[model samples]
Target: MSQLRVLRVVERAHGILSSRDADAPDVAQVNEAHRSLRPEEVSKAVSACDRRDFLSMSACSLATALLAACNSRGPDEAEKVLRFAERQNEVVERWLLRHTAMNHARGRIAGSAFPMYFISKTLPVWDTATRGPWMLDVSGLVDRPMRFTLEDLVRLPARRQRVDHFCVEGWNAVAEWWGVRVSELARVVGVRAEAKYVDFRSFDSNFHESWDLESATHPQTIVAYAKDGKFLPPPYGAPARLHSPIKLGYKNTKYLTNVVFMAKRNGGYWSDQGYEWYGGT
Candidate 1:
């Protein structure tokens, strides 16, 4: 089946399972969906199921039955079928992602109140007195590992773009961001060709995320210092934070501390907890 069609089937199957009422039609739908998949795709789907435990007992039983009706895998080996579907979704999302700059029209900007999100119990402020002045460290797979004071970042060439911010929880806002483009920083530091991923780390409970190099260096991706024409307040990740229209809110780590380039992907905090790792908008 085509990628899009395959994804639709997976989504249908999930909805059926979640409803907790997999009736006769739902079972037939799942069987028909699997019948459309190529032999290699079927094998891979079954293999992925065999590799990981399911997130819940009920989900496991439901998915196991769904797969058993088609592939005849044992219940235990069918638990991660959903995970396989997720990986396929990621592959399709990555293939479809583009680096073209998003339209940032001034009229699209939202009201002044952009939602603030951080995992720390209290707002995370950079205690310069205790931690010494906050510095952003850029290292790993680069010709010159460097540290930048907030002032140093301000001194770099700046870019301003108004873009929509999407949250995984189903809300979105539009805001203007001003900061040095991460691509500029990569150019200055001389990122090694082998570095295919970028890891963004934050001081807010050590929350972090990794991104493919293509998305990291997109023209609009920035390490933002200002929002809506004002220097960021503590609630909005003062000092500096990663921002991009291409990624979801959680992928843009706030209260920034470190940026590392790596050859392989290291999953993020939310991603490690079962959120989609790619997190594309």
Candidate 2:
């Protein structure tokens, strides 16, 4: 029920590999070792894992993503998942998404909730009644712990793009997202000399993702709000979400709670389960 899974990269190279002990890296020095990142692997490893195998495993992972959305107890959990996906997709297509690209947010469900049982919902989320300062605190190994409002963000320059979103679970989708450039955010935060890794957190309990700074400033990366031409849905991390050309589904989180910069990389939620925390794919 945690929506958290772990995957361990046992061995790599030569032939078929299948050992589950992540702690003991046998394969080309595995990335973040844990189960929280189930159905995930290095980019090249993903291709090597075989499409048939990934699809079958992804069926289960997708089910998990769906169940989390449909269940009533989960509340806006579905929206959160969808929002994360949409935002990530947005970042992917920020440059390519145009009026021609249909199904962009702000068109379908205006201030609505995502359906339950949706296989990995990519819905947006919001709360008109309550408004927050909307600050992207870039702390940790950065120069300043900067903060920005929604207007403050939108007012700044924007980036648009279109790209493929490869989920760790073995599936892909394309979408257009719009928001402030992450490259600018990095420039504002000013990464310090020691900064090497970046950690992202969500409002869903303590779900989080960790990635290298190299991916943080990716042009395709941005903190989005408007999808299509409307406010971002709640499940889509209405207030804000981090998007990057790097990392997998687990790395793109919804209902973003915090974005922390650290010198060394910290393990992610799914990483503890056996999944690769680095989530390069």
Candidate 3:
């Protein structure tokens, strides 16, 4: 999507997202960009929506669109962006339904009504040695592969940003994020010309996702270490989670365990649920 379109959706909705501001009241420019955009570009944005419309979206829905866009340019993983919406098509018949937008620690424009998943782990934290794998791997079509534990990540040079959180549902919040520069990791991995996609898998469940290498190494991209002031909560994919600019919430798998480099596009967990595999929102 055009930067103007991306900005207008967030600006007009007052949605939360993480990125540098270009200008104010982007609606006119955004509309012009939308008109000038080639058919393919327009389709790209339209395809991202499952059941999108001016009213089909609540304040929360708009928040999700903007914040998600602000975090990073739509995933460079592929030319396609897809998402699965579990909406039940219950016409809201009312305009003043009180839709509000906010930001998250990752600075995404999002709708808070959807909420996030929080899984509990009651492991033996009491023991100092049984801290699981302790290391996350970033390896693919590169000469250098990385295997860093939580400690290793914290020790590395870090970057921080304040941005809004966007959700597929509706609602948003802004927060600060601190993590390793994604570009640094890309250099460490030695991204090759053959490399095209970077897949992410979480440690929590089998939640997995893929992104184009371009978006992976974008300046806004990061392998975060902390949110706000405290360590990442388990529910928020503690230890490590990708702050991807090119994907939707579902694509941003939490508790990243592995980063696989690939040459073709791959579908995500929710893709089979009637959502597009390239869900960029």
- Give the candidate number with the greatest lDDT: 1
Error of 1 at 215 (Å): 0.7
In order, the Cα lDDT scores of the candidates are 0.85, 0.60, 0.61
Off by over 4 Å in 2: 1-132
**Given candidate 2, what's the lDDT at residue 195?**
81
Estimate the overall C-alpha local distance difference test score of candidate 3. 0.61
Across 1-281, the per-residue lDDT of candidate 3 in tens digits comes to 56567545544444233245554445665566546656654544546653444357677788787677664545444234322122222122112122132223554433333244633243212122665565678887877887988888888778786764555555445656788766787787787789888888765645677776665665656787677766776556677788743345666767777887778857666765555455544
Q: Each candidate: how many clashes?
A: 0, 47, 40
Model 1 score (lDDT): 0.85
Comparing 2 and 3 on TM-score, the stronger one: 3
Q: Candidate 2: lDDT of 24? A: 42
Expressed as tens digits, the lDDT of each residue in 30-76 for candidate 2 is 44343323454434343556666888999999998787667655656
Which residue pairs collide in model 1, if any? none
Return the lDDT, model 3, position 122: 38
Better of 1 and 2 by TM-score: 1
Clash count, predicted structure 2: 47
